[model samples]
Target: MIRELYRQYKDRWLLELTFDRLLRWNRWWPQHRDTGGLLCWGSDKVPPDEAAHTWQGAAYESGLDNSPMFDGVPFNTKTNQLQLADVGLTSLYIADCNALAELAQVLNRPAQAAELRQRAGTYGQALQMLWSEEKGIFLNRRTDTGQFSDRLSPTLFYPLLAGVATPIQARRMVDEHLLNPAEFWGEWVLPAVARTDSAFTDQNYWRGRIWAPLNFLVYLGLRNYDLPDARKQLVDKSNQLLLKNWRASRHVPENFHVSGVGRLPSEALNRSDSFYHWGALMGFMSLLEQDKAVELKKTTD
Candidate 1:
């Protein structure tokens, strides 16, 4: 169903939001563009406000609500309506473009496939401008200043998932950053913020918590780069955390505390839903493992 929809709309205005996000080329952007990256319903005069209620438009888009990464970054505020172009959104858009290209190929639409692939590659090129050599991580660039955001979130690793990072970059990110105990790695693994960052706080949603989707994305990137062992380690840790939480609370929480691994802190403010489907990503794990098996079989064959 999704593939058919993609086939239908891939050529149309489906890329309008993506274009606005990647380049902000649209001078006359729609009101939905102002709503924290969410596609909301409304007119040019007034639209549903996501960021007005809380300063979490971009964070919400990343599924990490209240991540400090968006701190001080005005997005969809009453006083200001800023369109954020973060590395995560750009990379994800690139990935989506590539996926749609594959669907086009399956339908024997070579021209459409080539066009989508080229578009994806172009977006990937644009995404590279966000790389910060000093930080050794990709940061979000404000469309306003075209300057990178100082806040480093787990979304930094998303370039790898987009297949935009070079082999050397991926190695450095996975080795020096993602796997570093003082950075994202801990008991549960892959906190939202680097442990060395002052903003990092265990149990804080998106501040330092472990999220299944975040790890799953990194896992996909690791596999894409043929780092099977690292991918396995991530999958193992993620599964362990989920199982631990399930055993303790008899359900999975939206995000798990880095300090406690599987347990949510009772005293922690701004608690999340104890059970959310997006965080589960159960089928994602199965699909990844299955892909791994297929790869292994192909190699042996």
Candidate 2:
């Protein structure tokens, strides 16, 4: 779909901006590790002295906002180096590179397409290097020590979205990790943090809340692999959670309590944008469900 968009409208400002961004994304170091490389801060953002020692220098770039994954990791804003390489970021980086390569090919830039494709393949290789057979998941690795993080988050499955995982790997991720009752699975599904992780018990921020966008991306990933059953499970659970909240309060929220437990909290900390656009992903899921039903009916007939 993204490739089609670029092909259809390469002259548009959006694609131009996208091309420029991918061209400049060289700030990320993909060769430093096998699982992925650290994305350094742009030279304009951090001073050389502060780039290696403080998380305060760089805002946590992963959307989890205040995830505990960076609790003690030092970030250098000047050089854009953190001690760790994120599996999610790496996988997405590979996907983006591949997308840009396709765009370049559409624009008749054969050399540019080849370069971007090579870069994408390299990043994909590093992403695979980060796999943990023991955990049945891809994990973040320390840039300096090559250690993997024990904490798990919904973003852990992003390799599927990036097409960085092989069929076997995706199957393990889905069956052994994603659907595991002790991990991501819950009544509403896909918490920001795994249910068994220590952070899961914390209702604060990205510790354990359900975010609409993450689930939507994971749903797309499942569909990419033709995992219709898994995809439907996520779509149904997501829509159910959204409708339950909407029926009760007549609002779409920015995020929600894990599993839709209890009433959507009224506390200031728990309160979110009452009508966030992303929460309307439930409507999108509804369309997907409808399409699936139509397809099923056709098959039966």
Candidate 3:
């Protein structure tokens, strides 16, 4: 389906690459900083990767984390700390870990290869430093401040998505944090930033709105951690939100409000389309089937 979608929108994607990725006038490098990966889109924002940080060149496009691509072969951990000269410096710390883990899983599964080991180290640091045991969620860090964002965004599932979190941690996040009535539980899987959060402002930070791509990541992370029931609920919520937007606007919005308030069409054609946020709104069939599978397992058990 993803392949088919890509093919269907090949023309538009080429344009996105041109307008969003490339520089004009026969420039070899893209105008957007090549963090060796993709940059997070903020509302009128250029992530640190392009401006304050540097990219060495290897980027994970699927991730929303801040990573800098570097020219060196393998980053020598002992000799290296983050430097402004490197691209991919800033990342949604957890998202990058999950992306790396999946890459490791695909290439190394349960192996303890060198690359996997390095990734594991990162995973360890992420969980240890970034996870809020009290909140049962992961938080994004501004790095410069050394404090976690008080607003709870869905970026915490990086470890769960990456399969780095233990089953216990996954279950806690699912049962407590993500599903808690006071926390993230939503008609959909909750907004990128819960409106209830003090920092949530509709026009600020990343448009002060929910984002489909990040929603997609959180959903996958939960699923990866084997939180089947929570995953089902989230998938169902995603569809409901998508349909709600479609019903209201005759098309999907890039994101909706946690309280189901803003169902209007996305302001621009950026990344809110179903085709683009393919991760957030699960196709109805897939979500239903998975829910059925989980139900069947529960019944048998």
Candidate 4:
């Protein structure tokens, strides 16, 4: 399956574009870990397959609010040198770095481990300071308005779930942001940003939708951090949400509302671009594996 997926994706346009998005850093690029370290941040609201949304991936594009430049970090693939591109939202680095760290640990790659550690440090510093406690979320550090995005999003969970924060950091973060009954436990936690935060709206797909991949990140992040009970609860709840949706709509929708209502299926192309879209399946199966979650339907709503 791995070999087939590689063969299937290797020379496609998406892969071409994906490869083009690698780090453009001048001297700080790694020579060993480039394959995993993204040279650019992903678009804000668009799924990987769409090009019309934030348009912020790998190129020095015509539009983008490049920011939060991470300096002097040193994880890279052997094929590539230092990777330097526009640093994206805090969540991006945390999730990727944590995954990198795990891959390093599992593969017994010491150099990659060192690089992942340094990158995690930079990401942690950013998350701790960047979060506006009053708002209970991390805002995009764009140059515009000099104001925060004014939303509590799934992005915040990435840092904690990705193994970027220490235990103290995780506990504080979970208490303050996630595990809070008032917020995180909602019908599945409203989509990315909270509805009460002046940023919530039904049409704002990402801002309020309950995305599977993001939830998966939370489950995996908590599991990686050794919060067994917390991880179990989240995994269980997330699975409940998925099964609920699967039952209602025979087919698994890309995402759901905080209300647990499935959204209309997207009409985007490259439906087969697993990495680019339909990442929700990955989340569902992940939780299912851990919690013995069930699939209630095969036909999507």
* Highest-TM-score candidate: 2
CA lDDT of each candidate?
0.65, 0.72, 0.47, 0.48
lDDT of 2 by residue, 1-301 (tens): 4565655665655665566566666333454222234342212243465532346433344555677666666664434556667777777777777778877776677888898888877777777878999988998777667788888877779898889888888999999988888888868777888888777777676778888888987886787696777888888889998888888888788888775832345557444667789988865877977977898999999
Q: Model 3, range 57-82, lDDT digits (tens) per residue?
A: 22222233222111122322222222
Please provide, for model 1 over 1-75, each residue's C-alpha lDDT reduced to its tens digit, 9 standing for 90 to 100: 244355566653444334334333221222244233322111222247645344454455456566776666655
**Clashes within 3 Å, all models in order:** 0, 7, 24, 28
Lowest-sum lDDT 10-residue window in model 1? 37-46
- Superposed model 2: Cα runs more than 4 Å off: 1-18, 25-53, 57-59, 76-78, 259-263, 269-271, 289-301
CA lDDT of 291 in candidate 4? 39
Candidate 1 ranges beyond 4 A from true positions: 1-59, 76-84, 261-265, 268-270, 282-287, 298-301
What's the distance in Å from true for residue 276, model 3? 6.0
Clashing pairs in 2: 34-126, 35-126, 40-80, 41-80, 46-78, 51-76, 51-77
> Order the candidates by lDDT, highest first — what do you get?
2, 1, 4, 3
On the 0 to 100 scale, the lDDT of residue 31 in model 2 is: 41
RMSD of 3: 10.5
Which residues of candidate 4, in runs, are more than 4 Å off? 1-88, 98-116, 131-149, 264-301
Best prediction by lDDT: 2
